[model samples]
Target: MKLNLKQADTEIQPQWQPIVGYPCPPEFEPSTWVKLWQQPNPYSHDEALLLCQLTEDEWVAWIPDQGETVLYRYQFFQR
Candidate 1:
């Protein structure tokens, strides 16, 4: 479990911003159970994305790709 924040060598707080909104589609109702987490990009350990899990099956990931924040939806495997 190694995190590669280049700035982790320095101060950590100001590097990240608070995610002000949730990117839920119309079918999904917002949940009260929320925890904020920063996960390193699987492809690039040097970067990270702010993510929140909506349910056991779904989550939203926000990335600052370039100068804009891009939103992506991830779904777990269904049985």
Candidate 2:
């Protein structure tokens, strides 16, 4: 969950904007974003395989036969 300081400076700051489409509420805080990034996956399968195409700030969570969900960190830079 490393953050790209350069990218962050370019994409965030000024208004502290996040990459669009992440599940961030209007009032969400930066600390909350960091917590989400640090959360461990409860799934047993290969997490890396599930995240192959995703950037560091991007993530995919498997929900078994229920399908998968693609997630991104709002206000976080891609590692």
Candidate 3:
């Protein structure tokens, strides 16, 4: 997955960071299945569709758990 370095710099860094390497994974294409590596809870088809529709900023603002804990951009992935 490609990361937006500028966006990352603007946000407060999360304690749990991913360790990505060379030959980075392909970008996320719009799909019915998506997953967050850190979280086991699966998103339903409708929810996944909604997620695909959201912009990066909108996704960041939308807390999947609806709690104060913030989710970083890199945590998102296609299942």
Candidate 4:
């Protein structure tokens, strides 16, 4: 799965799903205050970043652009 950075920054789309159930840990903020990936560039789907919110202010993403799971900040994005 790929992540659409532009859409995420502007508005929450249906593609952004709550990471729930067994995949999500109990320690995580109930898998409620977060959203996940959506392919931004169709041509570069494989290279798109996998964005996920850790908390209201803390956001983490698997940034394929930089090739790691690091903090990715974008404008217009809010919890």
Candidate 5:
């Protein structure tokens, strides 16, 4: 099913900071579960908001630090 970010179903918490890195291409999507880097060249990490809005085979997420949204596949992520 398709989901939109403007809807109440997608809520991001204030404590969740944006992950570090530029908006990576879909091909560069993490090969495994990746931690949300709190700082560039991170020595530590923080909880990231995995705001998923499904669109058939793809998913949408927000990156506040970059001020942009990214589309990726849910399967690319793991715990």
Candidate 6:
């Protein structure tokens, strides 16, 4: 995926905030970090929205800050 700052403007704030560097987990691949975005919920203290890339070979899954044990997997093709 590519980062289109111009296109992102319509969806997100125009400000660019640097993310603190953190070591990627050994289990995660470099592509896993591509074109990802996250936002915290203003109404809920522990809620967040995570957007990520999905591939045919692999699917994207997430466990919310407060949610059931089930893993919510999403396919990129669906989008």
Best by lDDT: 3
In terms of lDDT, model 4 sits at: 0.40
Per-residue accuracy of model 5 over 1-79 as CA lDDT, tens digit each: 9777574666666695556886645432322333342422234233223455455555444433442244444433433
lDDT of 3 at 10: 61
Candidate 4 TM-score to native: 0.24
- Window of ten residues with lowest summed lDDT in model 1: 70-79
lDDT of 1 by residue, 4-62 (tens): 86764565565755556965443432322222233344442223233555555555544
lDDT of 6 by residue, 1-79 (tens): 9876664445655896556796543433322322213223334223222334245344343425442221133212121
What total of clashing residue pairs does each candidate reach?
0, 0, 0, 4, 0, 0
Candidate lDDT scores, in order, read 0.37, 0.41, 0.43, 0.40, 0.42, 0.33
Q: Write the per-residue lDDT of candidate 3 for residues 1-79, one digit (tens) a residue.
A: 9876664456666696557675656655443344554552444221232234355433422334542223345655555
**Which candidate model has the greater TM-score, 1 or 2?**
2
| Model 2 weakest 10-residue run by lDDT | 27-36
Tell me the deviation in Å of residue 45 in model 3.
8.7
List the candidates' TM-scores in order: 0.21, 0.23, 0.27, 0.24, 0.27, 0.17
RMSD in order of candidates: 19.1, 17.0, 15.8, 19.2, 19.0, 16.9
Clash pairs of candidate 4? 2-38, 2-39, 3-38, 4-38
Q: What TM-score number comes out for model 5?
A: 0.27
* Model 3: lDDT of residue 22: 52
lDDT of 2 by residue, 13-78 (tens): 376767788876443222221223432355422222233226645656443433455556552232
Give per-residue CA lDDT, model 4, range 1-79, as digits (tens): 9876664456645686676664743433322232234433444223323355665545454433334343333411223
